[model samples]
Target: MTGKPIDGGAGVVSRVVDVADPADPRLDDFRDLNSVDRRPDLPSGKGLVIAEGVLVVQRMLASRFTPRALLGTDRRLTELGADLDGVDAPFYRVSAEVMAQVVGFHLNRGVLASASRAPELTVSQVLDGAATVVVLEGVNDHENLGSVFRNAAGLGVDAVVFGSGCADPLYRRAVRVSMGHALLVPFARAANWPGDLEVLRDKGFQILAMTPDPQAATLAEALPPRAGQPVAILVGAEGPGLQEHTMRASDQRVRIPMSRGTDSLNVATAAALAFYERDRLRTTVST
Candidate 1:
C-alpha cells in the first residue's frame, strides 16, 4: 500500500501510509516480531535482518543491507526526514496501538527496517587489505557482540571475524545495540575454527589474543611497529577467554595492564582498548 505525502522538510519527502489493520498482510514481515521462537528474522527460520530504531534504520540505509520496507509512527517519519529522500522502501505509518498489536509489544524505538539477509562473506573476503581486525570466540551474548562491532568501527578496526560459538551478529537486538555498525562492519564466520588463524597469519596479520592472565605481554609491548602492519586482536567471551587451542594458534597472547586483583574488562571493552592501543601506537610512531 502506498502512503500520502507528509510535510517533509526541503530535500526530504516522506510517504505516510496509515496502517489501520494490525493483521494486514502488507505488514507480515513485522508481525509477531517479539515471538521468542517464531520471529521472522531468526537465522534458523526466515532469516531476515531487522534494523530497529531510527539510528539503525539510518545505518541500514547506508549499509549493504537494503531495507525492503519500513514501519513506523508519524513522529518517526518526521524524525527520519531527509534520510529517507532517496530510500526506495515504503514507509507504513501506523498508530501506536496498532503498531504495538502487530509487533506483539510496545516498541518505544517506534521504528523498524527489515531486509533480507545478504549473502555471507568468507574470512579472506573480510581480511582483504585489512590492517586491523577483531576476532571473537565464544561471544554468544548479542549485546556484547554488538558493542564490539560499534567499538571496532569507532576505534578503526577494519573488520570482525567470528570464531566458533559466537552469536549471530545480525540478531535484532544486536543490530540495535551496535547503533547499526553491525550492519556496516564487514565480518565473517570462521569455516574451520582456529584453523582460520593460519589464513590470517599467512596474510601477514600479527594475531594478538587478548587475555586476563597477568603474565602475558601488555598491549603496549605486543602491538606491531607503525609501518601499517596488519594486526588481528583476538578476544574471547568474558569468563572462558580464548580457547587454549586458539591461544596456541595465535602469534602472541597479550594482556591489558590493569590494577592488581581486579577482574578483566568486558570482552567488547577489552577489544576497544586493544584497538585504541593499536591506533595510539600508530599515531605515536607517525608523529
Candidate 2:
C-alpha cells in the first residue's frame, strides 16, 4: 500500500509512512546499520547502496541509483520536502529514538535511503569520452576512497577507475565521506588489472603514475606536454604507493613537490594533488 501522505510543502508528494516499531520487518533494509555482518551496504551483506543524511539522500534521488525506500525523521522529510516529490519509494518516518534503536546507533545524520546495487559499469564505459580519469591501486581505506571521489568531483575529473586492492566505493562510510559524490561520479573496476591499462593507452590517454620518489619529474613537468591530450592520473595506497608492475605500466612517474620534511601524502591527499594539477593545466590551456 502507498503510505500516508506528507504535506512536505513545495509539491513534495512522497509516500510518508509512519513507522514506530523499530522491529518492524519492513524496516529490514535499514536495520542494524552498524553491524559488520548485517549492514545493507556490504557486498557480502545485502549489497544495497545506502545513502545517509539529507544531502546524500537527495543525491541518491538525483543519481542513477534509485532509492527503493527512505527512512528519516519528520524534520528531514520537511527539509527534503520539495526533493521528495514523485519518488515511488516510501519514506518511513520514525522518531530519533526509534531510528537509534533500529540502526544500532545514534545516527545524527537523521536520514537514510536504500537502493539496490546498480549493474557494474565497464572500464570502457567509464572511460568513454573521458579526458581526465583517476585510477586507484591498493587504496583499501573506505574514507580515502570516498575522499578521492569527492576530490575527483570537485577538481574536474571525468571518471574513476579502480585497480587491484581497492575498497568498495559504495560502502556506507565511503558514500557518507564522499558527501554523495560517490553516487554522482561514474566509476568502473578493471577486469584485467594492469593489463586493462592497455585500453587507456589505446584510447590515447597518457597515464602518469603518482609517486613520492624525489627523482621522478614533478606534475608541472610531466603534465604540460600532455595538456591538450587525454590524461589518466594513477595513485596508490598510502604506504606502498603504486605496485611496481603498475608503475611500469604507466607512461610517466610524477610527484607533488613537498615541503621541508614531508615525504608523502595520504592516498586521498595525493590523488587530490594530482587531480588539482591536471585541472590547473587544463584550465590554463583552455584560456
Candidate 3:
C-alpha cells in the first residue's frame, strides 16, 4: 500500500497488486481518462484529481491530496522507489498493455495517481501571511494557467486567485503542464469578480494590474513603492488582456517595456515578469 512499510519485526513489503484485466472494478477511477464528454477529473463528472508520471505522483503523495490508488507498470513502481514509502494508497501494478487498455492510451509517464479533490479554499485562506499573489481573469487556457502556476511557485508568488472567466486551475492538462504545481500552489476562485478583488485590497495588498498601455508605469518603477506591503499581480487572458472594470479596480497598472513591433507577451510571461519584479523588490527591502 506504500513505497515501503514500517518494520513490523521485518522489512515492510510494497503493496503492489498485479492486475491483468483492464476492466476490473478496481480500475474504474482510471478508466477512459481521455473521455471528451466525461472525464473523472471533472467536478460534475468523477471528481478526482489525477497526477501523471513519477514526479507528479510524488508531489501528490506530499500534497494535500492523498492518493486512494495508483496505476502503473512494474518499471514505474521500481522507479518511484522510496517515494512511495508509508503511503497508504494501493499501487495497482499492471503491465503496459493492461494500463494502456484501462486508460485508453499509452501514457509514457507510465504512472498515474488518483486522489480525491480537496475542498476549495477561500481567497482569505490562501493569503494568510502571504506577501505576493497572482490574480487571473479570463485566462481560460490550461497550458497558460499551468505556466502561471509554475512561475508563481518559482518566482515567490504566494498564492493564485481566479477571477471571472478563468478556467479551472485543477484541470488535468493544466496540472500536467504545470508539472504538478497546480496541485501544490494554493488557489481560490473569486466568488464575485471585481467585487472580490476589493477583498484583496482590504487585506492591505497593493493590486498591480498588468497592462501594455504606454501610460502604465514600468515594473521597476511601480513595484518599489509597494515593497513592504502585500502585493497582488493581476493578469488577463493573452488576447483580450484585463477587463476594463478589472483594470479600473486595480491600485496601479504596470507594464513591461517591449520592442515596438513585438506583440504583448503571453499572460503567463507577463505575470512572471511582474512576479519576479515584486520578488526582487521584496528581497531588496528585506536586505
Candidate 4:
C-alpha cells in the first residue's frame, strides 16, 4: 500500500509533481551525483551548486544563490511548507526509492535544492562596510571551511576572504556542513596572495594572524576595539600556520592561550575565540 502524503499545516500550499522513472530527463541535474566526472560542483564541469537536507535547503532559499530546481519526497515538501512559497523553482516530487537511484545515494534528508552559482564577489565587495572578517589560507578541508563559515555567522564575522589554497565553500559537503551559511557568508578569493594583505591594510583593517608562537599576543591582548573599525583575523590550516610572508604582512600575530604542550585549537574554534574576543571588547566599551 502507498504511504499517505505528508502534510505540515492547513493553508500551506506545496506543489508536488510525481516522478517515477529514475532515467527521466527531468531529473538530469539530480542524477549520478556520485560519479566523479559527472558530479556537479566540479570547477571544470557543469559546476551546479547543490544544497541537501531541510536546513541547508532553507538556507539556500535565504541566500544569494537562487534555487533552479528542487527534488524531494512529499514529506519534505510538507515540512518546507510556507518556506517554498513564491519560490520559482519547480518541486520534482519523487519516491524515496527513485530519489536514491537517481542521486546514487539514499538522501535521508529528504530534500535537495540546486542553484546556479552566482558571480564571484571581489575582496572589496566582501570587505566593504565590514567590522570583522576572517582570512584563511591553505584550509583545503571542506568540513573545516564549512565550520569556519558556521562559526563566523554565529559569532558576527562580516565576511570571509580566501587568501590561497582554500576549498570551494559552495561544494555540496561544505554547504551542508555549514548549514548553508557558506551561501550567505560573503567571501572572496585573493587575486594576489600576500600582496592582498596590503589592500586590507589600506582599508584601515588591523590584520591579526593567529598563531601558536608563545611570543605572540593572546586573543585578549591582540584584538582592537571594534567601535565600527574593521578587523581581519588571519587563520591558516591546522598543520601549517599562515605562510611566513603572510604573517609578515599582518600588523600583529595573535595566539590563543592554551595549556602548555597542548598545541592549538581547531581553526574554526580559534576563529570563534577571536570573534568572541572582539565582540566582548566591543560590548565592554559600549557599556
Top candidate when judged by lDDT against the true structure:
2
In model 4, which range of ten residues has the least summed lDDT?
1-10
**lDDT for each residue of candidate 3 in 34-81, tens digit (9 for 90 to 100):** 998668888788889999998888888878988999999877787777
lDDT of 1 by residue, 111-142 (tens): 98899988899999999978999999999999
Candidate 1 clash pair list: none
TM per model? 0.92, 0.94, 0.93, 0.92
Compose the digit string of candidate 2's lDDT tens values, residues 183-211: 99999999999999999999999999998
Task: Mark the 10 consecutive residues where model 1 has the least summed lDDT.
Answer: 1-10
What is the RMSD of candidate 2?
Answer: 3.7
After superposition, the stretches of candidate 4 with alpha carbons farther than 4 Å from their true spots are 1-15, 224-228, 281-287
Query: Residue-wise lDDT of candidate 4 within 1-287, one digit each (tens)?
Result: 12334453333334456788999987887887878898877767878889998888888999999988889987888777778767877788899999999999998999888899899999988989888899999999999999999988888889999998999998888888888999999999999997998889888998999999989999887775444678999999997888999999988899998898687788888888988888874443321
Instruction: Report the lDDT of model 1 for residue 45.
Output: 82
Q: How many residue pairs clash (N, CA or C atoms closer than 3 angstroms) in each of the candidate models, in the order given?
A: 0, 0, 4, 0
The collision pairs in model 3 are: 1-15, 3-84, 3-85, 4-85
The true-versus-predicted C-alpha distance at residue 207 of model 1, in Å, is 0.7
**Model 4 CA RMSD to the hidden true structure, in angstroms:** 4.0
